[model samples]
Target: MLFAAGCLAILLGITHSILGEVLVFKRLRENSIIPNLTGHKFNLRQIRILWVSWHLVTLFGWALGILLFLLADVNNAPATLITQLKQVIAIAMCGGATLVLLGTKAKHPGWIVLLSIAILVWFT
Candidate 1:
């Protein structure tokens, strides 16, 4: 479970960075896909900054997930603390996924897979 979660976290981190920094930001800067899809005028600099911030947040989330997995594997903490940590991770991941799916209507497969893995790891 820990291994699976760790690997998924790393994969998601990479995917998020690529999608946000390269794909989405590029489109926004070029005034191409995003303006058409969103139907909103965006200042290139502001949009770029926003996406960069989002990318950083995603990377931070992945780092936290990895840290949690390592802490669980080491078994160096009290049982209660570990249990609490797992619950927090589960809630955070699931809630984030839910927001992405419903709020944004995102078609990204990576998010769906991340949500599935998060639920599975939480249970197992």
Candidate 2:
């Protein structure tokens, strides 16, 4: 459970700090500033660069996280339970990923996934 919890913490942290910035602050930073405006002269481009770099790094982090979570879950779970739970998790995860990938960030989709995770946690 500790390992799974650790993975969840890292996952949530990356989702919030890294991906959330991309999803939230990216637009704000884009629209908030006027291009070619000079501060220290380095400020404008720096924010853009930071945004891009952050997104890129977070993409990598997410990729790593998917693999890590998969491995961690597999490693921690007993074989019988793993088989029983695999299909449910796959459906929930893949369906959730598909919905999120389709450019829908509505609360419904995320909440559904959250509820499914809750069920999984409860059952397992």
Candidate 2 lDDT over residue span 1-124, tens digit each: 6456557756764776555565645454434421223234455455444443444344444444454555556545676545544544554454444433332323224445644664674465
Least well predicted 10-residue stretch by lDDT in candidate 1: 30-39
Candidate 1 lDDT by residue in tens digits, 1-124: 7767777777888888777757566655344433223316655444534553465467557857666566657555677666666766676567666644543336434458658866976996
What is the alpha-carbon RMSD of candidate 2 to the true structure? 10.3
Task: Score every model by TM-score.
Answer: 0.44, 0.35
Prediction 2 global C-alpha lDDT:
0.47
Q: Kindly report which residue stretches of model 1 are placed more than 4 angstroms away from their true locations once superposed.
A: 28-40, 75-124
Error of 1 at 85 (Å): 11
Q: Which sections of candidate 2 miss by over 4 Å? A: 1-6, 9-43, 73-124
lDDT of 2 at 65: 49
